[model samples]
Target: MTGGSAGAAAGAPWAEFGRRLRSLRRAAGLTQLQLGLRVGYHHSAVSKLEAGLREPPVGLVRRLDAVLETDGELAAILAEPREVPRRTGRFPADP
Candidate 1:
C-alpha cells in the first residue's frame, strides 16, 4: 500500500474512508447492526464497509450520512475518486 511518492501516503483511499466511516458511526453511537438496519444493508455489509474491505453504494453513503448527521462529509468522502499509484517497473532510485 506504499506509494512511491512521499506525498501520496500509504494505504488505499477506500481503507482510509472506511476508517472515517467507522469513526462517524462511533461518534453517533450507532452500532454496525443498527446502522445497517437504518441504511438497508446487512450488519456484515456495514462491517465490511467500515473495515474498508468493500465499496459502499452511493445510496448507502447518502443514507449513512443522513442517519449520522455528518453534514455530508461522509458522502463527500465516499464520492471521492481513489487514485491508484502508477508503476513504471523501475526502482525508486532509478533515473
Candidate 2:
C-alpha cells in the first residue's frame, strides 16, 4: 500500500485476478479458511484478496501460487495481469 498504490491499484486486471483466485480456490475444493491456513493468512485476508479490496503481498502471492499448485499463474497475474487472457473455463465461475 505504499507509494500511493492503494486506491489506484484495483483495475480490470485486479478484479480478474480476484476472480482467478476464487476460481482456483474453488476448483481445489478449498475454503478461504483452508487456503489461509496453508498460506499463513487469515480467512478474512483471503476474502479481501479475492474481493480486490487489498493488494496481496508478493511473498504471499508466491506462496499462494505454490500452495494452490497454480504453477505461478497467480504470481503471473500480479506481474502482468493485463496480458492474461481471461478464461472462465480455466477458472470456475465465481459465485
Candidate 3:
C-alpha cells in the first residue's frame, strides 16, 4: 500500500524519519524530484518516504543521508527499535 497505517503516522519512527528527511531536503533547497534523482530513486518514492508511507531500505537511507548532508541523523532514526510484525502460521515463511 502507498499509505502509512494510522498508527505508523502517529509518531512512529518511520514517520519521524520522514519528517527529518523533509526538513533536511528543504534546508538543502532541493525539491523532491531533485532529491530523488540525486539518490537514484523516483520522485514518487521520495514522496512516499516523506509521507511516511514506506520504510526506506537501508541502502537508500544511506544514500539519502549522504545526499541531504544529514551527518547520519537520518540513519539514527531508523536505527531505533520498532515492532516487527510476527508472521502468522497461515503465511509462508519468508525466504
Candidate 4:
C-alpha cells in the first residue's frame, strides 16, 4: 500500500490514478473546470481523465501533482507495475 500504489488493488492503473486525482482535486477545493484551467485542459478533458476514460499524458500528471500538492503521490501510481491495455484498431474497446 506504500508508494501511493494502493489504488492498484482497486482497479487499473489509469482508474486508480483518476480516483486519486479526484480526491486530491477535491481536497484542494477546486472544481474540475478550475483544475482544467490551471492545467491547460478543458473541463471535459478533466472530466474524462477523472472518469478514467482516457489515459492522461505524463506532463499533465506532473502538473496535477504540483497543483494538488501531492509531492509525487500521483506520479507514483503510474510507476506501479501493471499491464496497460492497448487499442488495436480504429474502433477499439477497453479490456
Candidate 5:
C-alpha cells in the first residue's frame, strides 16, 4: 500500500474509536446511561469511553454493535490493533 493508505489502514486510536462509539450512540438516540444499561456497564464507564479516557473492551464492543444494530462494524474495528510497519533489516550504520 502507498504510505498514505497504509497509514489510514492502521486503525484508529482509542480516542477516535471512542468518538465513533459516541456518535453511533447518538445516532441511535440513546443516552450514555441507557446505552450503558444495555451493555451492562456503568454510565461513567460509557462516559469515559466516549470521552477517550478508556478503551472499550471486546465484550463492550460486541454489545455496542448489537445494541446499535451496526452490523458488526464496531466489533470489527475493535478486533484490529493499530497497525505499524515492520522493520526488515538493521540500519546501515550498525556494526
Candidate 6:
C-alpha cells in the first residue's frame, strides 16, 4: 500500500476501532441513537463514527467509554496514532 491509494489503506485501523465500538455498544444493548444521546451527539454522528467516515472526538470517546461501560477502552483507542483533522477533517476543536 503506497501512494494515492495508501490513504484508504491507512484507514483500516480506525475502521476496525469503529467496529469494536459498535460491538461494545451493541453488547451493552444500546442502539446508535441511544449511544449518541448519551454522548450528546446525533445518531448519525454515531453512525459516521462507527462507519469510520469521521474521527471520534476525544471527549466523545471518553463519554462513550462511560456510556458503553467499557471502562477506558474507547479512550484507549483514541490514544492510538491516527490521522486527525489535518488529514481526516474530523478532529475535535481546541478548547
How high a TM-score does candidate 3 get?
0.75
Q: Report the error of model 5 at residue 35, Å.
A: 0.4
Each candidate structure's TM-score, on Cα atoms with residue i matched to residue i, is 0.74, 0.71, 0.75, 0.73, 0.69, 0.70
Q: Which ranges of candidate 5 are over 4 A from the true structure?
A: 1-12, 83-95
lDDT winner:
3
Write down the RMSD of all candidates, one decimal each: 6.0, 13.1, 6.8, 9.0, 7.6, 10.4
Give the per-residue lDDT of model 5 (tens digit) for 1-95.
Answer: 25664355335366666777889999999999999999999999997776666768888888899999999988777677776678979676756
Report every candidate's CA lDDT.
Answer: 0.78, 0.83, 0.85, 0.82, 0.79, 0.79
Candidates by TM-score, descending order: 3, 1, 4, 2, 6, 5
Distance from true location, Cα of 70 in model 3, Å: 1.1
**Model 2, 13-91: lDDT tens per residue?**
4666787999999999999999999999999999888877777899999999999998999888888725656566676
Give the alpha carbon lDDT tens digit for every residue of 1-95 in model 6: 23644356347556766778889988999999988888899999987777666777888888888888888987887677866545666878999
What ranges in model 3 sit over 4 Å off? 1-8, 11-13, 83-95
- Ten consecutive residues with minimal summed lDDT in candidate 1? 1-10
Candidate 6 deviant stretches above 4 angstroms = 1-13, 82-95
Quickly count the clashes in candidate 5. 0
Question: Considering TM-score, which of the candidate structures 3 and 4 is the better prediction for this target?
Answer: 3
* Model 3 Cα shift for residue 6 (angstroms): 9.7
Instruction: Write candidate 1's Cα lDDT for 13-57 as tens digits.
Output: 567768888899998898989998998899999877766677778
Least accurate 10 contiguous residues by lDDT in model 5: 1-10
TM-score of 6: 0.70
Error of 6 at 74 (Å): 1.1
Q: What C-alpha lDDT, on a 0 to 100 scale, does residue 93 get in candidate 6?
A: 91
lDDT, model 5? 0.79
Which structure is stronger by lDDT: 1 or 2?
2
